[model samples]
Target: MKYQFPENFWWGSAASGPQTEGAADVDGRKPSIWDYWYEIEPGRFFNGVGPKNTSNFYYQYKEDIALMKETGHNSFRTSIQWSRLIPDGIGEVNPKAVEFYNNVIDEMLKQGVEPFMNLYHFDMPLSMQEKGGFESREVIEAYVTFAETCFKLFGDRVKYWFTFNEPIVPVEAGYLYDMHYPNVVDFKRAAQVAFGTTLAHAKAVKAYHALNLDGKIGIILNLTPSYPRSQNPADLRAAHIADLFFNRSFLDPVTRGEFPSDLVEILRERDFLPNYEPEDLEIIKENTVDILGVNYYQPRRVKAKENMPHPDAPFMPEHLFDNYEMPFRKMNPYRGWEIYEQAIYDIAINLRDNYGNIPFFISENGMGVEGEERYRNSDGFIEDTYRIEFIESHLKWLHKAIAEGANCHGYHLWTFMDCWSWANAYKNRYGFVEVNLDENYKRTVKASGKWFKTLTSQNGF
Candidate 1:
């Protein structure tokens, strides 16, 4: 009936700058990658809604913070838009953008909600992309300058800082897959992007620590635990490979400061390795994060590939593994993701045993539904008992992990308020409070929001 976290545990939700801020062009804020991508391919976004129609947190941050206090947030996670700060990516810090963030930080501090800020999410300044996004080492230098600026500007009051949020997603989406902007399908380019991102993360960390700011800085990684299809050795090996690629690709370097030898061997075997100077390894080795933020959504159900692809079919991850859904795996009818509660504990235990028990927190986790408002009653509140159940299920495992001496410190949901997703737009609302776009951003706390308030107040549901 009750479980109490450590006293003063962080209690809030995670949000990104592009998803919340709506002042896309005003006050010297230039267009980010999302803005440029949506412009070039208007049909790529959902409901034809672009970044400008985001939750409009730029204008409603005051009211939103009051609502966060009302719903029992002691701390919150949000990202600073890279383009908003440095319109051309590195030069000229926008004064209006600084004022906007200063107001946000002051508001959060006034409401007793410690602000956890991340330097970059998926949004890259379009101008930077024009000059060769993550591939160009010059862009890496630009990122260093931008990260340093953020530390100097906001590091005084903000104690928790993140260098990047889910860096792999952008690499995969933009370089390998075609879902994100600057879409390219070259495996060599993908390798380059991945390597460059790791370097950029280290450079940012190096810069932040050099400032001697009084705070902790880390990176947010989405670690998808891998499960094999069967007990067969081949399936087990396949699952291990999947884990190495999806989880350890970023994890091994960030936490352990070295790439997994097995992964390196595989890359070398396929001739897909990136050009790495010896110093690149040194950068990763010395710049391990102060903390870690693990975002676990679902487990990766994998089996060995049924058949090999042609010689030139390209080196995709799933080429070595196949997603195999177990017959009895629990599924969310409203969504496609498998709902395995134990994965949360498994993730915590993995971090404890292998990652040196680094202090960490859950940066994002939530269920997305196509039509959440269908369950609303006459009072205009969604009966999101499903969301409450989802949180409780994960928390029970988290509480057990903490009691067992895992170094997990806190938990944050996917979002605080509904915001526009990439191509999904507002179709998938994963928030404790729902925002009505038609009503000019009117917010209504869902049933899950009320339950979360009580859970935070009591330290459990």
Candidate 2:
């Protein structure tokens, strides 16, 4: 059987500034929280490898853009580091950053690949962090100003704009899980950060609309479908609550113009509600996203908790439900993430049924593998047959959802080339083209890269 994608599909991958563009202290680029954190606690990062050791996209974007064209990329996504653009987070803009971004955008356009620009991707400026990051309303105002600056400068060429990539990550990592910067385990602070992030998103959207730019503005949310462990009512309720906290927490406000009332009630009942101004609610209600970007890598399988959390312990979402690892579920052994391809179709159907079928694309979806170098063939290319299979499985399900009237526009891989991750560094590679850091940052087209080229050129497998 043959499966074909829609015409003019956005066939490419997503990358970020901090993860890819490694000129940490150059070109008047001030420190982001990652840089500052790495400076303070070098041992926190994987193998003591920091953000400065990235793919060097800042210097290699032209070559990378050429590779994007080689891989049959009709469109590509990357973020502009806020700290690099406005070094102090507000007021004076850096001309070098503007020149670099303009060159990158123009180069992509020249190569016949459309540029999809995102404003933020977990890189908070050090100045913003000093002002309390997303937990402070002052930082939110500053973020809105930054967004407006992006619009005024580059919105003319970049048609697809995303306010943030995986906005829930900071709330989970920084506030609740202690995995990211300013690591803390406070439920109230998590809720406050989440609310402020969404409010800032809405304010950015409002600012974009006010300018009446030709481009469309939206957000990239990593939506992990919550699956119940059993058919019991308690299990179902547990899944529902998990969905509310993880998925609908951002989805509802961006797509439907309001937060889930049930979620709010639970927060209020627990006295964990975030501080909010009356005008913030109106701002969220008035400015919803014009489109959405969904990043699906895994599903959350949860079962109702049999024991309640200790009153003395700090509050966390996991206290309400226990994660269930199915005995026979397929898994990505390298990353320890469940491989559930059907979740892609489920997400599409969800959007069609509940989100006015608003136009969207798969912003990030791919398999990550550790020690991918072992798969390198004698021909100097990595034979990533597993990645090819992984992508095809998901694409088939995505195709089914689109056939069933889901308004999905296209699919973009998690990344273009192997790049540095926050704490993980470059341990796991999730790229069609493998980056050989030891060999002068050489870019080699993997077997999956060749396969993707064919897939994009043919519109499908």
Candidate 3:
């Protein structure tokens, strides 16, 4: 039951700009899509706690980097708000935003904690969304410009760069599901948005390598392994379809420089294929990532849809494949996601063999538990045994994958400080360090925090 990581393995945590930074309208920072969406649809978020009231890490990053070091992080991944850099998403670089980010990045370097910075994480400058967000090819060009600016500004010191974080989710939540901003349920627009994003990522990667930046660049994708109900051919094929849409849609394009034939065929069959140019394929092929970040939280258990709806029903992803809960599968009640640790190994090995063994990291994986305070002891520590088990179980599998020649270099959990989820808000906590919501930002290291420190120091739990 014991496991050890490679001697130089990276132990860290990951967070996004909008998720943690709270000064929504300060320091010459313009509103992002999250801020704009919350103002109009306050009811959309859980408990009405929008992006403005997260962890206050914007002003407390120095204190936070200290906490990261304390939690055994030699490296930490966070993002720079694009709106802060370009208030209008096009021209006029904001000096205050630059100054604030310089301070944060410098502080991270000072503490010997490598800062893996991402350019965008579901937070588009509100100005760009007005011009049709990813729908407009003009928006794609603007993103490349913003990306180049970031590299010129921070590429000297910060090495690790991610172009986007889970790009597919927005296309689903915003365009298809109506759960995120610019909510619209249209397949055509969703397909267009997804293609634009793929092109945008390729363009950014192209730009990064042109600048000849100091470090590696990659995309952070949420790759959930899809499982079939049984060996039945129908169930197996259904799982394959789900994986193509959710996992390979972005994965294949970015890592392999080509989209899957199965997915393209589906889109073609339904007349949902997005517009594409000949030059785009060359860009994607030439500018593939030097690294990858795989965010695995749970596995998808799928079965064929029980009933075929009328062909006219609005097409959602769920229409393609139905979710069926296995009678005996383990579950995380608070989070509503299944627990399948071995899937991590499956992901690692699959990438190794299929994606040419690109260097990768566990980008985002965590347990979100409600009312975590109940476990806090009088001595000011939370006995998060569940978190420890969840992590160890996954690592056991990850170790096996590494031994089998998977090119995994690191593991960064969902977050360091307790923060707000888009819809869940602060209702569920996933931080190793707990943040006090009622009072000033006071942080206490939970049992998981202490446990992680030990794991990193010893290179194992």
Q: What is the TM-score of each candidate against the true structure?
A: 0.98, 0.99, 0.98
lDDT of each: 0.89, 0.94, 0.90
Cα lDDT of model 1 by residue, 1-461, tens digit: 67778877777899999999888988888998899888889898887889985899999999999989888888899999989999999889999999999999999999999999998889999999988877888998899899999899989998999988998998889988899898888877887888889999998998889999999989999989999989999899999999998889999999889889998998899898988789988999999999999898889999988998887887788888898989988887655889888898999999999889899988888888878879998999999898899988998999999989899878999889998898788888899899988899999999988888898898765
Give lDDT for model 1: 0.89
lDDT of 2 at 156: 94
Q: Show the colliding residue pairs in model 2.
A: none
What local lDDT does model 3 show for residue 159? Answer: 93
Better of 1 and 2 by lDDT: 2
Question: Per-candidate RMSD vs. true structure?
Answer: 1.1, 0.7, 1.0
Steric clashes per prediction? 0, 0, 0
**Which regions in candidate 3 have their CA more than 4 angstroms from the true location?**
none
lDDT tens readout by residue for model 2, 274-362:
98989999999999998899999999999999899899999999888988998999999978999999999999999999989989999
Query: In candidate 3, what residue range of length 10 has the lowest lDDT sum?
Result: 1-10
Error of 1 at 133 (Å): 1.5
Local error of candidate 3 at 270, Å? 0.7
Among all windows of 10 consecutive residues in model 2, the one with the lowest summed lDDT is: 52-61
